[model samples]
Target: MRYIYSTLGKLSAEQLGMILPHEHVFVDLRTPDKPGYGQADTASVLALMVPQIEAIQALGVTALVECSTGGVGRRADLDLAVSLATNFPIVVPTGNYREPWIPAWVHSADEDELFNWMLAELTTEIEQTGFRAGWIKLSAGDDGITPLEARILRAATRAAVETDALIGSHTIRGSVVMDQLDIIEAQGGSPARFLSIHTQAEPDFALHRAIAARGAWIEYDNVGAVPVAESTDLILRALDAGLGEQLLISHDRGWYDPALPNGGVPKPYTVVSTELIPLLRARGVPEDTILQLFHRNPFRAFSRH
Candidate 1:
């Protein structure tokens, strides 16, 4: 049996319906040095996020993977508030983002210390929120996995091994997918429970195929950010190569930026629900396959057995 640890509580994998594998209900991407950057008020964020979530729910989305990790304006409390408001399950993560975004304490902590910290967050509650993280989220640089990023990744793998939690990584330029996998395997982590996020950024179908062949998951998130045709083509190419079971799709959307007036341009969570799915169907992708992409794949990706 497998269950997904959500902000509200643990839910059976079957309970995850039409999940958005990657999304951010509350995130502040503004630079910290500048005023108004990363300054989203909780009240305002809740007000803005709930309705958007409700709208996605109206479209039959039952769960979401809030990929906002530490040092990237992850608001676990905000995620809880929105989940409660909309009666939706949200699976949040515990880990750190790439350099500069990562906090000093994380950078200074030794591997064992970091591993324990992540393990605690996965098994226990995070910062008194009483919400255990569902997965470990990590980020690497475009050039490659930096030393700090590697440390975080290795620690995350160890934590996953202990907790049986999933690990999702933000791969820049898709350059270090193999290296990341090598480290996870070296640390005794299961590649099947790992996800190479932002995979479409690389546009190398062979790379995507290679990663999927290793029993890891490939995420084609960035739906609205990239052109729909190109994104769909990449997905179709992967499916054609018989990697559908190991594939995941999402918009990577939703963010309430406080820097601009009225929280900047709102990236609605409906792109995958409204635009991408319909496009896939019209392109001759079977309905069951679409269901697998939206529902089954997410359940397997987030669940801990």
Candidate 2:
């Protein structure tokens, strides 16, 4: 069954409502070798992040894609607790992050081993926590994908092909994304199932169109962090270029970081619901198109095909 797997349950797109395609509930960005990198008391994390999750629910945002992955401290079990407490859904990732933050074991692991790990996590459960991952979260370096990073990405790409799951990368450079797609295609993964996350980091909108042209998802996830006008201008330009179907927008916000005291300050996941949508409406973006972006596109992008 093709479905968007959530922490609570497997649901259809309509069941998910508006989705923050790229957001974090709890993240530990410290290097894996560091002390207490991805570990946190579930109760402590829930206490800090549940209210933030509730705040978004009030604004009609229902689910969010938890971008926390292996290198960056993904705790699907921790996120599942939050989903149960607030009756909210969280889509989790089953992949690794970029270099430097990547663990030594990952560097030593071979391509087939990495591929097997991801396939098992996607088909079975992550860390044997009784929760399956809904998609793949990956990242490439600013200049280019390293040899180790390329192996990991290649493994993720192959696993995504096998499971019919989506692959989203926190890629910095547009050129690197093109390289990543080449590797994915070589491994039999389609660009249609790939996502160029943090697409705004690449200042060239021409590259944005290029990504969309290749059939991958182009995500503008820094919505709340940047000026509303700047965000809208890019989004409107995307629509004008006839790339609406391949576009996504989000806050890239939230995250209860265990590394910080009291998990630091979490940004609210409300800008897209409260601000950007309204601005788009005022700019004559049709209601149907708005629904397509927040409602339909998320499901299409994340659902297991």
Candidate 3:
């Protein structure tokens, strides 16, 4: 059986409701060395972000993927606090981001050290949050992955293969995602367990197909951030090309920023519910396909069998 790790616990596919495959609750983009980094009071974050979570719940989104990984100031403690408060399920990842965003320690650490850290987080806890990581989230430079980033990628993929966790990168370029898949395969990770996040940024539709053809999932995650027609078109085309099972969709819309006052009036996480689905139905996407996108795909993408 395939199952996913949520804040609620290890849950099978039948346990998950409509899912937002990629989103965030709290993210601090400031580099770790800076002041005000990783210092958001849980009370303040809960007060400001819980309502955003609940609103999505009212719309039937029972689970969300909190894509804030280490280099971007991932706050697993905050994620747990919110989950406990609302009784909602959140799946968080274990990995680091690309250069400059990556912490100083990564530059000096050997590949095994990096792999062991990620393995511990996957098998144990994240920063003492008592919550083991559920997925793998990382990023790459737009031009290409830096040496340190490539080293981290190798380590991450090894951990991913060991744990059967899904690995997604905040990589904007499709070619870089191709490079990442190569590194992952070199580490003996299944390409099907890989996800090319922010794939919309790569306008070359052929790259999307190419990555999917190699058994990697292609994510169009910025649903609410742009014109609905543009997002609708990309999705329709992918569906037309019969890549439904290889595709994942999300708002990428979250985020309670610690840097902002009251988390800076977060953007709504409702585009998928309010706009996209209805548009998809209008354009002839059947309910089963919607069900596959919202439920089955996320489970199969994130779960370990």
Question: Which digits, one per residue and each the tens of the lDDT, describe model 2 over residues 195-259?
Answer: 99998899888898898888999999999899887899999999999999999899999979988
Query: Candidate 2: TM-score?
Result: 0.98
Clashing residue pairs in candidate 1 (N, C-alpha, C atoms within 3 angstroms):
none
Reference-based lDDT, each prediction: 0.86, 0.90, 0.88
Q: Can you write out model 1's per-residue Cα lDDT over 1-305, one digit (the tens) per residue?
A: 88889988899966668999999876766433455545666778777888889899899998999998887877788888888878888999999888778876887899999999999989988778898899998888888889989999999999998878889999956549889999999999988889999888876767888888888999988898978887788889888999999999999888776656766566899988888889999999999999899988899889885
Clashing pairs in 3: none
Tens-place lDDT digits, model 3, residues 1-305:
87788777788877777889899888888887888886788898888888889998899988999999987888888999999999998999999887788888888899999999999988887778777789889899999988888998889888988888899999999998999899888889889999999988998999999999999999999998899888999999999988999889999877788788877888888999999999999999999999998888988898884
Give the runs in model 1 whose Cα sits over 4 Å from its true position: 31-38
lDDT: which is higher, 1 or 2?
2
Q: Give residue 256's lDDT in candidate 3 (0 to 100).
A: 83
